[model samples]
Target: MLKWLRPLVLLLLIGLLGIFGLRWTQQNMRNAIPSANSRVSPIILVPGSSATQERFDAMVNELNNKTKTTSSLLKVTVHTDNHLSYSGTFEPGRSHPYIVIAFENNDDGYSNIKKQAAWFNHAMTILSTRYHFNHFSAIGHSNGGLVLTRYLEKYFNQQKMRINTLMTIASPYNFSETNIDKRTQMLTDLIHDNKKIPSNLVMYSVAGTENYNNDGTVPFASVEAGKYIFQKQAKNYTQITVTGEDTTHHDLPQNGEIVSLIQQYVLHISDTKQRPDVNVRH
Candidate 1:
C-alpha cells in the first residue's frame, strides 16, 4: 500500500515541475527585446574557443569611452557571472546609447559547433528575457563565430531574432579540411543558404596579421574566405585586414586600431549610418 502511494506523489511533483517550466517560458518570451524597429539594438560579444568574457574588457572600455565615434552611440553594460542584467536602462530612445551584452560561454565551444551553437541559442534566450531587447547586433571572436553562425542557420527565423550586423574578429573558419566539424564549410554552407539569411544581416570578417601572413593564430585567408559568401547571402559581407604588431588573434578583440576601425566602419545602428570605403563589397 505504501509503494502505491509513491507513484501518486511522484505524479504530483512532476505536474508541479511542468507548471513551473511553462511559467518560466512565458515570462521569458514576454520580456524579450522590443519590436519597434527603430531603436538601438543590443550588441553581444562572444569570446573564442577557450577564452573568457574578460577578453573584451579593454575594447569595451574603448568603445564606451570614445568621445566622437559611432560605437560611442551605445553605452556598454557588460553582463557578468554574478550580474545577470544591466543595472541601467534597456530602453533605446532615451539617454542610453546602446546596451551591450557581453557574456562568457562556459564551454567555449571548442569541439562541436552544433552543440555549442545550441548553447548560444539558450544564452540569447536568457539575455532576451533579462533585458527584453527587440533586436541585436553580434560580435564573435574565433570559434565563437562558428557557434553564432550555426545558430543563425537554425534559429534566426524561429523567433524573428533580428541580427542586423555580425562581426567576426580573427576567426578561423577553415581551420581544418577533414575535421568532423568543418568550421570552414559551415560558413560556406551558410553562404549557400544565403537566401534564408536575413537581408538586413550584415557580416564583417575582421582579420589581423601579427607578422606578414598570419594573425598569430588564424590565417588571413581563412578569415577573408567569407567575403564572397556574405556578399552572396546579401549579408553585406565586409573584410577588414589590418597589419600591425598589436593585432594578434587574442588581441583582435582588444586592439585599439581595429576597435577604432570597427567603430568608424562596421557599427551601424539606428543612430548612425554605415561608415563607408573600408573594403566593403556590398
Candidate 2:
C-alpha cells in the first residue's frame, strides 16, 4: 500500500508541476510577443457572424495582390489557425500587418467572445512590440465587429494603442430589441457599458436596406447603433449607406456596391494614390 501511494503522490506532483510550468511558459511567450502598434502597416481583420477565415480569402487575396502591385515594400498577410485551432501558434512568416479571423462551430457563444478577444489581444501585443505600427485598422462584419469593438473598449483604454480606422459591415451593434442569442446579448451589453467616445478613432458603419431593419441577419437599427456609438466617442465619424440592393445582412459583404464602398473607404483612409474597382460579386 505504501509503495502504491508513493507512485500516486509522485504522479500528482508531476501533474501539478506540468500545469504550473505550462502557465508560466504561456505568460512568458505573451510577454515576449510585441504589440499591434509595432507592425508596418498593420490591419486586423475580424470576420462577421458565423464566418471563418475562409470567407475572407478572396478579399485578402485581392488586397494583397493590389498591395503587391503598388509597392514591393508593403507586406499583406492573413493570420489563421490551422484546423481552426486557436492555440496561438502563428505560422512563422505570417505574423503582423495581417488579418485575424475567428472560427467557432460550437454552441458556446460566450466562450467564443473570450477566445476571439484573447486572439486579438495576443496579435495586437505582437504587433505593438515587434514592428511598432503607428496605425492599426480593424474590419469586422456582423457579430465579429461587435467582438472587436468590445475588445477595444476593454483593452484599448489601458494600452498605448491608436486605432486609425474601424469599419463594421452589417454588424448588430445594439441587439437589445431583437431576439438574438444569449451570447450575443451578453456581448452587446459588454460593449455598451465599455463604450468610449471621441478619441482619435475613425469609425464607419455600413448597413443595407433589404432585410427587416437589418442587412439580413442583423437589423439596420443595430448597425446604426454602431455608427452612433462611435460618433458619440469620436469626433471623426463616417457612416456610408449602401442602398438599392436587395441583399440581406448575411449577403452584404458579398454585395458589389457594399464591397466597392468598403474599398473606397479603405483607400481613402490609407490615402492610396490609386483606387481599385469594386467589382465584388453578390
Please report, in order, the local distance difference test score of every candidate based on alpha carbons.
Answer: 0.64, 0.59
Candidate 1 lDDT (Cα, 0 to 1): 0.64
User: Against the hidden true structure, what lDDT does model 2 obtain?
Assistant: 0.59
C-alpha RMSD of candidate 2: 16.8
Residue clash pairs of candidate 1:
32-132, 33-132, 33-133, 33-134, 34-134, 74-97, 74-98, 75-98
Worst 10 residues of 1 by lDDT: 72-81
Give residue 157's lDDT in candidate 1 (0 to 100): 57
Cα lDDT tens digits for candidate 1, 188-268: 665666566666677888888887768778777667666545666744778888876688788788787777765755453
Candidate 2 runs further than 4 Å off = 1-39, 62-97, 103-111, 130-134, 157-159, 176-198, 269-282
